[model samples]
Target: MTSNPPLPVRPTRTAQPGFPWQHFSMRFSSTPRGARLARRLAGERLDAWGIPYGSDAHHTLTLIVAELSANAVSHGRVPGRDFRLCLSAEGTTLRVEVTDTRGEKVPTLVEPSDALDGDGGRGLLLVAALTDRWGWYPCADGPGKTVWAVLEVGTT
Candidate 1:
């Protein structure tokens, strides 16, 4: 039930806002390899934005992306359709958004005890624990759902 983040308005088509923000968005095939590639590329983008590889922020964000991506591939996947990952970093707040082509499988954080059998299912729990905030919503642009996580890079 989380709301979508507001995007800055631009007066002119060629004008760029003077804000310290970085964004990366890409669509990937809804496969395990695609998820892995998304995670790696996300790390690269964060590093290019000065978070650097192996830093706490870099690691946390990467993990969040990986978990979200895995969920997109495993649960939300629609065969022949692709998933999308959108990343936006503004100052200390880094938001990770992964959208997949399935609306019925809304992500829910289950009880830890219920999922502690170790056959997986800890992804969301780990994301919830490591991130400042996280949630999902039905996609505004298409027929799917978007899972998101936010991290405060400065605090990490």
Candidate 2:
């Protein structure tokens, strides 16, 4: 059997955390369609980085992206403003960041979305349960906030 060739930008699996070797960033319209695209592109990017499409890590990271992107489009939308999606791989961890222009409406795990009794407030809750850690903060650039999640990815 032949060994796989080294990739130009694949991060070392044991490298220090918080330093990514591969990164992908893009801005999408703050619409449901844009959220869907973010999820798909994020999955594709992970696959290109050697994670493959059907692996546990790939599925997990993609799910987190979907939830975050959906939230950005739903609660964080700012009329004509678009949301941004950034993905990076550092060591064995994958980090996803979704930025939208509505910093005033931050997400809280304690209460989640609208009504606790309703079926609409569990997005962040699902994100919290699935990922290793997740949080949000005002964007450093301009207006809006950045919701982020990190998952520890490993071979199954």
| Number of colliding residue pairs in each model | 0, 0
In model 1, which range of ten residues has the least summed lDDT?
Answer: 10-19
TM-score for predicted model 2 compared with the true structure: 0.82
Candidate 1 per-residue lDDT over residues 1-156, each given as its tens digit? 899999987443111122268899999999999999999999998776777676777788899999999999999999999999999988677899999999999998878997797687788999999998999999888799999999876652
Task: Residues 53-137, candidate 2: write the lDDT tens digits.
Answer: 7777778789899999999998999999999999988777788999999989999875653547886878888889889898888
Please state the error at residue 21 of candidate 2 in Å: 0.7
RMSD of 2: 5.6
Q: TM-score for all predictions?
A: 0.85, 0.82
Candidate 1's TM-score: 0.85
Off by over 4 Å in 2: 1-20, 111-116
Clashes of 2: 0
